[model samples]
Target: MILRCNTGGTRTDNFAFFIYAFSSLFAIVSPVGGVITFVSLTSDMSLDEKNYLASKSVILACIIALFFAVTGQIILNFFGVSIDSLRVAGGILLFVVAFDMILAKVSRESVTEKEIDISMERSDIWIFPIALPLLTGPGTITTIIVLMGSAVSVLQRGEVIAAILLTFLITGVLFHFSRRIYKFLGYTGMLVFTRLMGLLLAAMAVNFITIGIWNIYLSFQ
Candidate 1:
C-alpha cells in the first residue's frame, strides 16, 4: 500500500483514465440533440433494419476506437510524428468540425438530404458513410485515439466503453425526440447552440496544439 502510493502507480493511473474517458464522452456525444431528425427520417425501416443500422454504427465506432487504441502510437512513431504533431493534427480536424458547427453547416445539406429512394438504397445505408465515417467522423476518431493513448488500465477501458454505450443510448433517445426539439429550438436556435459548442471546441484545439508542442519539446530532452 505504501509503496503503491509512493510510486503513483495503478490507482492514480486509473483515476486519470476515468477522467480521460469521461472527457471524451462529453466531447463526442454532445450532439445528442439532433437524434430526433435521424429517427423520423428512418422510421420507414423495419425494427430489424433500424437495430442493424444502430448496431453497425456502434460497431464501427468501437472498431475505430480500438484501432486507435492499439495503433495510434505505433503509427505516429513509424511516421516520425510526435504526440504533439498528432495532437496538432487532431486539433485541426476538430477545428474544421467546430467551424462547421459554429457556422451551422453540420446538418445543412449533407446529412438532411433524404432525396434517396428509401427502397432503392436502403441496404447500403448502414454500411456506407453513415456507419463508417459520417456519424463517427475524423474528429471522433482522433479523440478516441488520443484517449486510448492516455488510458491506463482495464478498468479505465471499461469506463470508456460504458460512456460510449451511454452516448449511443442518448443518441437514440434524441432521435426519438428530434422533431420536438427541432420545433422547440427552431433552426436559428440550433445554429446558435452549434456556434457556442464550436467556440468551446476551438479553445480545445488550441490546448491540443499547445500540449502537443510541449510533448515534442520534452521528447528531445
Candidate 2:
C-alpha cells in the first residue's frame, strides 16, 4: 500500500496511479455491460457452456489487453506517435464512448447490434464478439496504451499489469454468473450502474485531455 514510484527520476506515490489504473479500466471495460451481452448471447446454453465461454472469453480479452499494454510504447515508437498525441486522441475517443454510455446507449466503438447478431451465428463466439469487440475493443485498448505510456518505472508497469489482470478476473466471474446478476440487477439497475461508470470515465477522459495538452505545450517550450 506504501508503494512508491520513480516518475522521470522524481520519487512519487504509486497508490494514486494504482487507483487510477484500476478504476479507469473498470469503468471502460464495464463488466456489467459485458455480462448483459453475455446473457443475451448465451440464452440457449446450459450452465456449463455459459461458464466455459465466460472463462475462455475473459482469458482471451486479458491476453489482448496485456499484449497492447506491455508493448504499447513499442507500438507508439513504430508508428512515430507520441504519447501526448495519443492521449489527446484517445481521450477524445473515450469521451465519445463515455457520452454514449452516459445516455445508456451502446457505443459502436465497443460493439453494435448487427455485430452481436452476426456473432450469434459464429461457433467461436468466445473469440469473436465476446472477447474481441465486446470486452476489449478499441476504446479499452487505447485506454490501456495511454495508461501504459504513463507508467514510467518497473513498479509502475507492474501496477498497470495487475490492474489489467484484476479487471478481467472480475469480468470472468461476472460472466460466470451472468444470469443471476441479470435477475438481481435487472436491465434498469445495470443501466444506472453503466451511467455512473460512464460519468467516472468521462472525468478520466478530461484528465487525459488536459494532461496531453499541457505536456504538448511543455514540449514546445
Candidate 3:
C-alpha cells in the first residue's frame, strides 16, 4: 500500500499537539515557577535590583530557549545524552508534578528540592519566584527548547513565541488571582487536578524514555 505522506498536515498536526502539550505542561508547572520568581525578587533585592533581575531572568529564559532551538541536539551530543533519556527524566519530573497537583501537595520540592533563602522579606516578591522558576523553570525551559526544535518552519517562531506569551499571560492572571484561586480551588481541588495532570505527564515521560533508549539501541545496531 503506497500511502502518500501528508507532510503539510502532519507538520500542522504535530505543531498543534506540541503546542498544547507544552502549554499544558507550562500551565501545570507555572505556579511553582511563579513562586520561585516571587521569592527571588522579594528576597534581599531592592526594587531596582528586583526589576533588573527579573528582566535578566526573562532574557535568560528566551536565550536558553533560543539555544535549545538551535542546538538542543548538539547539547545532547556533547553530553552523550539522548532525547529519550531527557524525555524520560523530564517525564518523571512531570509525573511527580502531576501527582502533586492531583494530591494537592504543591511544595517547592515537587520540582527542585533546593532550599531558598527568603532573607530580604521586604523586596518585591512578584519578580522572584513568580516569574523565574515558577513561570520559567527547568521543565519550562527544556520544553521550550524541544518545541523550538520541532518547528517545521522558521515562520513558526512567531507561533511558538505567541504560545509562550499566551501561557505567560494566563499564568499572570493566575498569579494575580493567586489568593482568590487558592481560596476558591482550595488545596483539595488543586490536588485533584494535579493528580490528573500527573498521569498525563507520566505518559510523556514514558515516551521520552522509550524513544531515548530505542535511539541508543538503534545507533549501536
TM of each candidate vs. truth: 0.70, 0.94, 0.64
Model 1, span 13-116: residue lDDT tens: 66666665655545544444244334544567775666666666656655665666567778878888766677888887777766766776643322434432
Better of 1 and 2 by lDDT: 2
What local lDDT does model 3 show for residue 90? 62
The true-versus-predicted C-alpha distance at residue 168 of model 3, in Å, is: 0.8
Instruction: Candidate 1: give its CA RMSD in angstroms.
Output: 4.6
**Against the hidden true structure, what lDDT does model 2 obtain?**
0.89
Top candidate (lDDT): 2
Ranked by lDDT from best down, the candidates are: 2, 1, 3
Whichever of 2 and 3 has more TM-score, that candidate is 2
Estimate the Cα RMSD of every predicted model relative to the unseen true structure: 4.6, 2.1, 5.5
C-alpha lDDT of all candidate models, in order: 0.60, 0.89, 0.54
Tell me the tens digit of each residue's lDDT in model 3 across 112-197: 33423452453433334443455556666666655554455554544666666566555545544444555677656655555666
Ranking by TM-score: 2, 1, 3
User: How many residue pairs of model 3 clash at the backbone?
Assistant: 31
lDDT of model 1 at position 201? 69
Over the stretch 84-190, how does candidate 2's per-residue lDDT look in tens digits? 99999999989998999999988878888888888888779899889998889988999999988898777777889999999999999899989999999999999
Q: Whose lDDT is higher: candidate 1's or candidate 3's?
A: 1
